[model samples]
Target: MNDREGGPSGLRQRTRRAVQAEIAATAMRLFLEHGFEATTMEQIASEIGISRRSLFRYFGTKEDIVLGDHAENGRTLKAALEARPADEPPWEALRAALKALVESLPYTPEDFLKITGMLHASPSLRGRQLEKRQQWTELLLPDIARRLGATANTMNELRARALVACALACSEAATETWVRSNGTVDMERAFDEAVAAVRA
Candidate 1:
């Protein structure tokens, strides 16, 4: 057997990830059925046959479960942006990076739409999501700045910040539209249309 696959550390890591996934899945189900605000962490833990304390070890709060780990997500987005071809236009690179980000999402498309709709409708959840997304801006700005050949000059820095902010906003808009339309809207196409509209 492969050492990495069968080693104690690897085994423990795998166990922890599996448990985390289960907790998240159970939480999502409860949130959707009972409503995010109506659902309690203890209810989620009971449904999963784990203690509420154990659930906290995996997620600090219900919001954390719904949003996942934004810091980790920011790192992933930055890496994806860095992997884009240097010659690609900044806008094109950002669009491609967003596609990569979608590939990392945990839920099925159906669940995603439901969760997104719920999230957007919830003031607290939307605020929390926005706050977390704000942290991603810094991680993304460096790559965006490089792509634009931007500099520390105030206008250039603002331009870089604007581009990154626009990309994130487009992503959010597309997802919200997709959810609002009850999955009739093609999310990728909606995102492209938004980006094109901005460019125009």
Candidate 2:
């Protein structure tokens, strides 16, 4: 439990997460103000009062800095899926899980729109967003397989993957619709409509 034993203790872990969040917030602020392409790693590092080397220790690239929260969100989505009732149908469970995941997002609607707008506008960030979506699918794979009582067979694996992909597609459609409406539409309602459309 102690840091000296082998790994970081709870407090140390919290402190590290706090620092990472602070760094990410600083980077996002700079990205929004100066534009992602105009912002430099050195500028972000200097803003945080850390050397470029130290900044690299936290994030590999500028794109990684902006997309850093994706990892946490992926973990959250996976956890939400796993926490769904075992007796629930796969599609229903996935729908509820997706709702919980969206509701748990750290950003407000305006902030989410701003961040996604940046991602949509920047080629590098758009590529990173796609990469992160694949990562999210991978994270959900095992849970999807478990929920479906899938055996260790190619067909079963494919089924689980397909289901996860379906859920992701529905969520993406809902998100796009909400964003296009400029946050005027209720996200939960949009999500339900998308899920219903897919089920039909």
lDDT per residue (tens digit) for residues 1-200 in model 2: 67663456867778777888888999999988898899999999999999999889888998988888888889988889889988777888888887787789778878888777778779998888878988998999887787778577888789988988888887777777777777787877887888788778
Off by over 4 Å in 2: 1-16
With candidate 2 superimposed using the best TM-score fit, by how many Å does residue 112's alpha carbon deviate from the native?
1.8
Looking at model 1, residue 192 earns an lDDT score of: 92
**Candidate lDDT values, in order:** 0.87, 0.84
TM-score of each: 0.86, 0.84
lDDT of 1 by residue, 139-165 (tens): 888888877785667787788889999
| Models, CA RMSD each | 3.3, 2.8
lDDT of model 2, residue 28 = 92
